[model samples]
Target: MPLFKRRDGGSIRDRFEFRDVLGTGAFSKVFLAECKAEPGHLVAVKCIDKKALKGKEESLENEIKVLRKLRHQNIVQLYDTYDEKGYVYLVMELVTGGELFDRIVAKGSYTEKDASHLIRQVLHAVSFMHDNGVVHRDLKPENLLYFNHEEDSKIMISDFGLSKTEDSGVMATACGTPGYVAPEVLQQKPYGKAVDIWSIGVIAYILLCGYPPFYDENDANLFAQIIKGEYEFDAPYWNEISDSAKDFISHLMCCDPDQRFTCEQALAHPWISGNTAYTKDIHGSVASHLKKSLAKRNWKKAYNAAAAIRQLQLLRISSSRAVTGNSSSNGTPPNRPFPV
Candidate 1:
């Protein structure tokens, strides 16, 4: 019996009105929903299967515990949690704009200036999470959400399913997105918050070039490429980017986790530090310029623009299907590293 079902064996829909399925993952499903008591207040409801969390009771508790203590502009806000018949549900804020990956796929690539603006926001958010003693572990594009449709949109790091609080100086969980995982993590070595910075480097690389730095068809080969630091930038994609931007990524992608820059230090790098125009007023502040701009636009227009971009990308993908089929084509996949 699911925790969310009624004693009479009714479904969750019998109570709350589930609007649309936002997404589905291995462990749970996310829905845009509204409660019977509050029809106008929209919310994102994540439903985790009781069976999926069966033996991981401690993990679930820890997730809630860490989320409760987090209060950062970049981190998603958890509004409430409820356990019904057999399902566990988490109510969260629903950002109007979609995943950052969607926007990045639409534009193919971003200018160094724009990339820097986005990375700064990510760095501030990660810094705040580190200060609060939480390590996100998973910081991929899929987990990043934009508040609205804007050039400098507010980015919120969501999906804390792999996050954990560390007190012993380092954590040894072999968790995180494959290409973005730090070398230490791939090697099963103990690591700290610096792992997040390493992932950020991968993200920055993708933002500038429109593809992940280390990629291979085979998982083992992919991990090897990442560990060996095998990467290159095509002239077409990187010709206009600054040397400072490249240097910053190189420093963060260092194989030795100990040598990688901390979130604070990374923020001070020339690429991020020099771009003061994009930095928020305080640490961890989302880019207000983009957020405000998005707020002023008609949402319907913004939606149409976003939809058009997606269609364009799909058409390109369809036309180049044969070329993309080659394992080494190195073509940037649509929004795989979604940039907002």
Candidate 2:
């Protein structure tokens, strides 16, 4: 009963006036809502259809549990949750600035320094999550959002659907976007918080170069590349990026999780903490690659890909088959179109 109650002791439906639809998923729809008690006070209300979440309830519940415990400036805040007869409602902080990469592509003068600053904030939030025993299994650019449209708007990490707690114990589940997943994950090896750090490394790589480090038309080949930790900074792209920046990525993207840089270590690296990050404008190259590589990928395509991956996982689980780096050779792109 308390979950549905607002500060004014009214039910959630009566407390907030729901507005335009913000997002839609297989089983849920997020709406922009304004608190009636404080006019103009806004929030994102995710309305989930229980009937549609028959087999997927656990994922939603897990996300709620993880979000409820996380309190950080860079992480999206989950304000409250409620369950009604046919639907469950999640009231959350409304971030209006849009996706992280969109902001970067739109900027007139993006540089390594700017990329470093953005990654620093992400590292801070992820470091907090690690300290709290939470692993955001999914840390792609799509998951990174901006708090507002201001030039100095802070980055906010959103979408905890794939997040897991350390308490869950030995995490061997093959999850996360194909391009950003860690080597250990692709190999189906037991992984920990290092996966998130690896993802950050991949994100850092893309930030400097505008395209993914590991890419292949085949999912099996892509997995193989990641499993081997084979990726290059490349010319034209890396020609302008400083060595310190590349070093920072190498540390985080190490194949050995034990050797991979922790969030703290990454945060302290010269690229992130010092002045080694180049101030030169690489916006032309970066933006060009971003548009050429990621422009065609819309939210719907990403959502569908994620759904297909989930279904594939379910089938794999049912068959009691282990998915090794080489197992998925069907040539089918699991989370293709790359970085969702």
Maximum-lDDT candidate: 2
TM per candidate: 0.73, 0.88
Report the C-alpha lDDT of model 1 over 185-266, residue by residue, as the tens digit: 7555678888888889988876665556765434544555565666666555466566787889998888787788998889
Worst 10 residues of 2 by lDDT: 318-327
RMSD in Å for model 2 = 4.6
In candidate 2, the residue pairs with backbone N, CA or C atoms under 3 Å apart (3 or more residues apart, or in different chains) clash, namely none
Which candidate leads the pack in TM-score?
Answer: 2
lDDT tens digits by residue: candidate 2, 1-340: 2234445555678989999999898788999999998999999999999899788877888899999999999999998988777888999999999998888889999999999999999999999999999999989998999999999999999999999999988898878887888877766678999999999998998998887877765454555567777677666568988999989999999989999999888988989989999899999988887876665575223432244346545555311232344433322334422332
Model 2 scores what on Cα lDDT? 0.82
Minimal lDDT window, size 10, model 1:
279-288
Candidate 2 segments exceeding 4 Å error: 1-9, 298-340
Those runs of model 1 whose alpha carbons end farther than 4 Å from true positions after fitting are: 1-17, 35-39, 107-110, 150-152, 168-170, 276-340
